[model samples]
Target chain A: MAEIVGAYFTSHVPSIGGAIHRGLKQDPYWKPFFDGFPPVHEWLAKVKPDVAVVFSNDHGLNFFLDKMPTFAVGAAPEYANADEGWGLPLYKTFKGHPELSWHIIEGLVEEEFDPVTCQSMLVDHAISIPFELAYPDAEQWPIKLVPIGINTVQHPLPSAKRCLALGRSVHKALASWKGDERIVVIGTGGLSHQLDGERAGFMNAEYDRFCLDNLVSDPDALTKDSIHEIVRLAGTQGVEVLNWIAARGALGPGAREIHRNYHLPISNTAAATVLYEPA
Target chain B: MPSELEPIPGTTLFDGEAARKGYALNALCFSFNEKVNRDAFLADEAAYLARFNLTPEQHEAIAKRDVLGMIAAGGNIYYLAKLAGIFGLNVQDVGSMQTGVSVDKFKAMLLAQGRGESYEVAHKEMLNG
Candidate 1:
């Protein structure tokens, strides 16, 4: 049967792509973080999952104002690569597993979480960034994907509570899928810090640490906090922590903080690589 | 090439007023009428600016509609489309409406028909950016 053999929590900062693409890794400032992330790179290379169910918020490519779903799963077979300004150097289309994608979609719906399904779409960084760095070649890293686009970009987005509930639903949905291949659930985006206006340089190491600590043990407390609290502490866009909570919730209490790293100088926010569920 | 967005069909996008509020809120901040809303926003630019730690030039790009520059300024694609919609342009089109046409071909058709006859402040990228 299909199983979530593993789960990963990461921060997919777009500028990181800019930094790496520009060969900034050797730059004194960014070198440290990349050093911390290599083990994560190795883990993904090893797990080599059959499919990656990604959770991220669009910066606006796939869904726009006409309609934005709090949560949408891509049932599409293909997604085009977008030139996300800093130039997403690695560009190749993402292949979606329509069969598994729709199965998760139907399952989520049956669980009462109405998720939108896109048959054709253009995925922005949310799906591409980690993907580019994690899975560069189609033949080797042939992990089909199921993208769960969250509305973290929009305000009054689903509450931390709602997102966790949805995560729990995802756990149940996948739990019942009968397949032999292994799957990896990845929650991309966030630790503290807001990168906008006067808040551009805001960094909350205290909150970042606390959140990471609880993520392995008590996720409900974080998920129960109001959006207002999350924004007040992490900045408005920082609420993307909801994605982290959802990932933890799906990984269930079986998760272990196998690995954790934080680097904020590159950007005000923290970047971490956490492994959940012992294989 | 459909007359309207095919309704994304069965998803509950939101419950009741939630979706409406999202659209209205987005429109209020990013729509062409942003100026009208700015009076209220301006009352407390500090609070507004604090939400997004943008540089002055960055703020100007968003206010000015330098699409590409705005993207570099840290703006996302959705709000960019909202800005486009405010300028009487569709999100998919480029310099001339004739450039990016789709099912809403009529909107593009109407836009291309009026080409350079009239202009809006937000329509000029070089002047603004």
Candidate 2:
């Protein structure tokens, strides 16, 4: 059976990509955000996950509103990063674990969750930035990937409760899969910062601290708030915390927080990173 | 029947209504993902925007570089971001434009929030007033 190694949750602010490209990791503006990744890197060196299952939201790169999926999974042999209209450089293509992806897809259907399965999915900054942060200097990514995209851009998005259930179902699928691959689940985006509207520069540190504490101690509590409430408390784009909540669900109960770092204003985002190991 | 969604002040939920209204405008912004399209749009902004057949409000909003006006015209921020990029405006620049603050002050507000200052309350009060 496949071994679920751990989970990582982080913000995937696009400017981090530019900062990385411009070699500004040590610059004062970016240092704190960049500093959060080293501990995760050290842990990754030790655990050496063979496959990564990423839960992230797309930002109009792959799916436009014309045909948006509530939840989409990638079963392609490879996934590429493309231009996101802003100035972030394109990232390296990621190898996919199609076999595992299919298994999970089948399992999700069996468990009564419908997800659009993509043979070819273009991952945006939400996946690439976190992956780059995790493996800063990998010439070729060491692990195969299974990219799962959740709808965050459009309204009427899947509820926080539904996202949690999806993650739990994925956990069941991973556990049942007949493989020995050590898998790491990653949830990327948000620690509270809104862009758009009169509330554009909103960042809620109090709410973010509440979420960070609850993500480890009581994820379900975080889900109790309605999406509108979440937006009010966390900011509009800050609702990307749904990704983190879902990823936490995959880790199951008693997933200990190995490390966490929270920093503010990483390109209009309250950036954060948390690593979790299952009990 | 689904219950009505309460409005969040200073926030526009990109729900179905906005999505429908913003489709043409957003599609135009989405086209910016390609370098050819971006260059074309940059070379002739009016012509490029017209190609999408955006609503008059959207067209005017883009012409005026009005972030708030664009939102009121149903421009989703995610897509509007691509449009902002063409103007070399990052989120802070957009925020500053929307809130009538300088970019530095906008950034400072964010830093203050991160450092545990409560601008959200003040901003909310301003919005309510």
Report DockQ per prediction, comma-separated.
Answer: 0.04, 0.78
Candidate 2 residue spans exceeding 4 A from truth: B121-129
Give the 10-residue window scoring lowest on summed lDDT in candidate 1 chain A. Answer: A194-203
Clashing residue pairs, backbone N/CA/C < 3 A, model 1 = A1-A179, A2-A179, A196-B52, A196-B53, A197-B52, A197-B53, A197-B54, A198-B53, B1-B103
RMSD to true structure for each model, in Å: 15.5, 1.9
User: What lDDT tens digits, residue by residue, belong to model 1 across residues A1-279?
Assistant: 876778877788766777766878778767766776677777877776788877888765566666768888888888776543222454567777888877788888888998887898777766676765565444434777788888886555788888888888887878887876688888888866444332233345567778888877778878766666677666545677888887776665567776777775444445666777643
- The best candidate by DockQ is 2
lDDT of 2 by residue, B84-129 (tens): 9988889889998988877777777777666676866645443443
lDDT of each: 0.62, 0.89
Candidate 1, residue A254: CA error in Å? 1.9
